[model samples]
Target: MSKATFAGGCFWCIEAAFSSLEGVNQAISGYCGGETDTPSYDAVCSGKTGHAEVVQIDFDDAIISYQDLLTIFFTLHDATQLNRQGNDIGTQYRSAIFYHDTEQQQQAQGYIDALTQDAVFDAPIVTQVTPIDTFHSAEDYHQGYYQQNPSQGYCSMVISPKFNKFKAKFGHKMKP
Candidate 1:
């Protein structure tokens, strides 16, 4: 299995988006890229821990390529936005792709370059492609938040739109 960490706005939304992919073995919401020892949901949300709300995805390479994952990641969120995605504005909600290996890093940079060259977004892509440092699991309530709390205001209003867009764009690649 290969791993990829991404912070594209809320971790709940990111988790829900990637969890639908066919080759994604698991997508766990967590806190990463911070200085805190063991960040909690509240601490991260407070933005005091400097941790970005991220999703750690485990995938089978035989079923999905890292490049494919990059494509999906770029499409699932507005890479053009910097330090924010929609109303969630904070360092913890920044757009980032945390790669584990050189291959993943190259693929991510390649995808960003291609998208920029193709004029994929009206504005420039501000997505940060960085290396993974540490990932601290979020509180249990945060895990599968969108799936577990579909009717919650944030999930229904914010996350569902992204989920719907992803389904429309990549439904052919979704799990059975």
Candidate 2:
């Protein structure tokens, strides 16, 4: 198994998207790329912890490549928007890929470069490719939030639409 960490906006959305994939063993909501030793949801949301809400995904490389995961990451959120996604605004909502090693770093950069060269977006991709830092798991209630509360307003209004788009594009990759 291999791991990949990404911060694309709300960790709830990212967690729900990746958790549906076949090769993914787990998609854990957390905080990363921050100075805080142990950041809570409120602390990160306050934008003082320097932590972006992130999801740590454990997956089998044989079934799904890191590059594939990167592709999904880019598709799920607006990498062009700096420090925000939709109504959510802050450094904590920035698009970032926290690579575990040099190889992952290179792959992420290459993918971004390819996207830029191809003019995949009208705006420049602002996604940050950085080294992995301390990953602090969010409070228990945050885990599987969408799964547990599908009827909630935010999940239904925001996360569901994003997830549906992902499912449409990558339905073949989803677990049966």
Candidate 3:
């Protein structure tokens, strides 16, 4: 299995979007790219830890390539949005790819470069492509949140719509 980490907004939304994909063993909500050690959800949410809310994905490379995961990630969130996604605002909500290896880093940078050269969006993609650091798993309540709290307001109002869009676009990649 290979691992990839990304931060595109709320970890809840990112977790939900990637968890259903084929070859994805798990999508864990966490914090990364920060100075602090063992960052807590509250500390990260306050944007004081410099940690972006992220999802650490474990997947089988034989089944789905890292570039494919990047494709789904870019589709799931607006890379052009800076320090925010929808109404959520903070550095913790910034778009980022915490790469695990040189290959991952190259692929991420290449994808961003291609997107820019092709004029993929009206606004420039502001996603930070950085080396992977400590990944502090969120509280247990935050794990599988969308599945566990489907009717909750945030899940229903925010995550669900984004999840639905991802599912619509990548339904073929979803597990049975």
Candidate 4:
């Protein structure tokens, strides 16, 4: 298994997307690219921990390549929207890829470059490609949140639509 950490707005939405993918063994909502030691969700949400609400994924590389994961991440979130996805605004929501290795870093940068060269969006892509120094796991309440709380307000209104679109676009890539 290989690791990939990404911050594209709420961890809930990111987790929801990757948790359904075929090769993904874990899509854990966590905090990364932060200054604090074991920062709490409230602290991260306060926008002071310098941390983004990230989902750290463990996947089978044989089943799904890092490039494919990057493709899905960019597709699921608005890479041009810096520090926010809809109303979830703050540094905690910034679009970023906390790369685990040199290969991941290079792939992420190359993917962004390709998107830029292809003019995939009118606005420039601002998703940061940074190394993940430490990945702080969030409280247990946050794990599998979308699956457990589908009827919750934020899950219903924010995550459901995005997850539906992801499922529709990548149904062939989903697990049985």
Per-residue lDDT of 1-176 in model 1, one digit per residue for the tens? 98999988888988998898899999999988999998988888898888899999999989988888888888777888777888888889988988898988898898889888998899998888889998898889988889989999988998888899889998999987
- Predicted candidate 4 versus true structure: per-residue lDDT over 1-176, tens digit per residue: 99999999999998999999999999999999989997999999999999999999999999999999999999889999989989989999999999999999999999999999999999999999998888999999999999999999999998999999999999999999
Where is model 1 poorest over a 10-residue stretch in terms of lDDT? 74-83
TM-score per model over all chains: 0.96, 0.99, 0.98, 0.98
lDDT digits (tens) for residues 119-176 of candidate 2: 9999999999999989988999999999999999999999999999999999999999
lDDT of 2: 0.96
Provide C-alpha RMSD values for all models, in order.
Answer: 1.0, 0.6, 0.7, 0.6
Q: List the residue pairs that clash in candidate 2.
A: none
Report every candidate's CA lDDT: 0.88, 0.96, 0.94, 0.95
Task: For model 3, give the 10-residue run with minimal summed lDDT.
Answer: 37-46
> After TM-score superposition, what is the CA distance of residue 12 in candidate 2 from its true location, in Å?
0.5
lDDT of 4 at 146: 98
